[model samples]
Target: MLYIFDLGNVIVDIDFNRVMGVWSDLSRVPLANLQNSFVMGEAFHRHERGQITDEEFAAAVCDEMGMALSFDQFAAGWQAVFVALRPEVIAVMKQLREKGHRVVVLSNTNRLHTNFWPGEYPEIAEAADKIYLSQEMGTRKPEPEIYLKLLQEEGTPADRAIFFDDNADNIKGAQQVGITSILVTGKETIPAYFANNPC
Candidate 1:
């Protein structure tokens, strides 16, 4: 059996509020304004979809927030949202791997987050058979094409694979492609799911 997982809020805990706080402090912008300007903007979407480079995203966000931080500083603040890996989830993944189930990670994340995560949580890189990012794929979740691409890459039938994600839209997207998906809500949910539904 093939098991696919989402990175953010699944294998790892992240808080966008942390990002808002960091950028607000560094840019001297009000939290409300920064949230309204950058987080809800098209620039962020473009960045996630690999339409823009990191430097370009930094410059655009700086302009939007009326900040003057250098690219390095901006990148640091931008990538500070991740808190830590969910150890239970990682353990579940490792267990699945040991059982000979193929495990893969699929996330709708940009280069900045991807660059920082592997260094901080090496287990993610070590555990998964393969990792797919929206930035690298030029597509994001809830989009059928991205799921199709993964299915093609793995040469696995959609119905034969199981996926878990924190987002409802992404879960529905996976279902649309005929893959069984679980919408994980909490850290313990996935582990419980695996315990109840053995491959």
Candidate 2:
């Protein structure tokens, strides 16, 4: 059987709220208001795609929040907020591979994150059979097209394939495309699923 997994939040813990909290203190803005303006909007997406540089996005965020800070200061502080992997999750992926499952990673990360991945986590780079990064593909999750691309590339029947992701919408998208789906909740549950539901 083939298994597809989400890279961030599922495999690694990513607290965007914590990053925003740091930005809030530096920019002297309230978290609730800043999130409404930038978090839900396309400011981050545009920045990730290089449509706007990090400095430009920081400036825009500052302008919207009615505060000021140097680009270097904001970038350095934000980069520091990202955390490392939980080793238990890495062990789970390695065990799945040992059982002969084709394990792949799918993430909606940008160039900056992808470039630093190998340095941050060598195990993921070495163990994953394949990786489908949205930045390179120009697509993101909850989009049927991206999942369809994975299904096509893996050449696995929908019934024999399973996907584990944190986002409910992405899980639904995988199910809609006929792939078996699991919402990532615990590291132990996945291996247990394979043992009982082997293909």
Scored by lDDT, the top model is 1
TM-scores for the candidates: 0.93, 0.80
RMSD of each: 1.5, 2.9
Model 1: per-residue Cα lDDT over 1-199, one tens digit each: 8899999999999888888888778778788987776654678878888999999988988887788789988987878889989999888889999999899999999989888889999999888999999888888888999999999999999978999999999999999999999999998899899788886
Model 2: residues with Cα > 4 Å off, grouped in runs: 35-38, 45-69, 186-199
For candidate 1, give the lDDT of residue 169.
95
Q: Model 1: how far is 184 from its true place, Å? A: 1.4
lDDT of 2 by residue, 3-37 (tens): 88888766777766776787778877788876676
Candidate 1 has a TM-score of 0.93
> In candidate 1, residue 55 scores what lDDT?
93
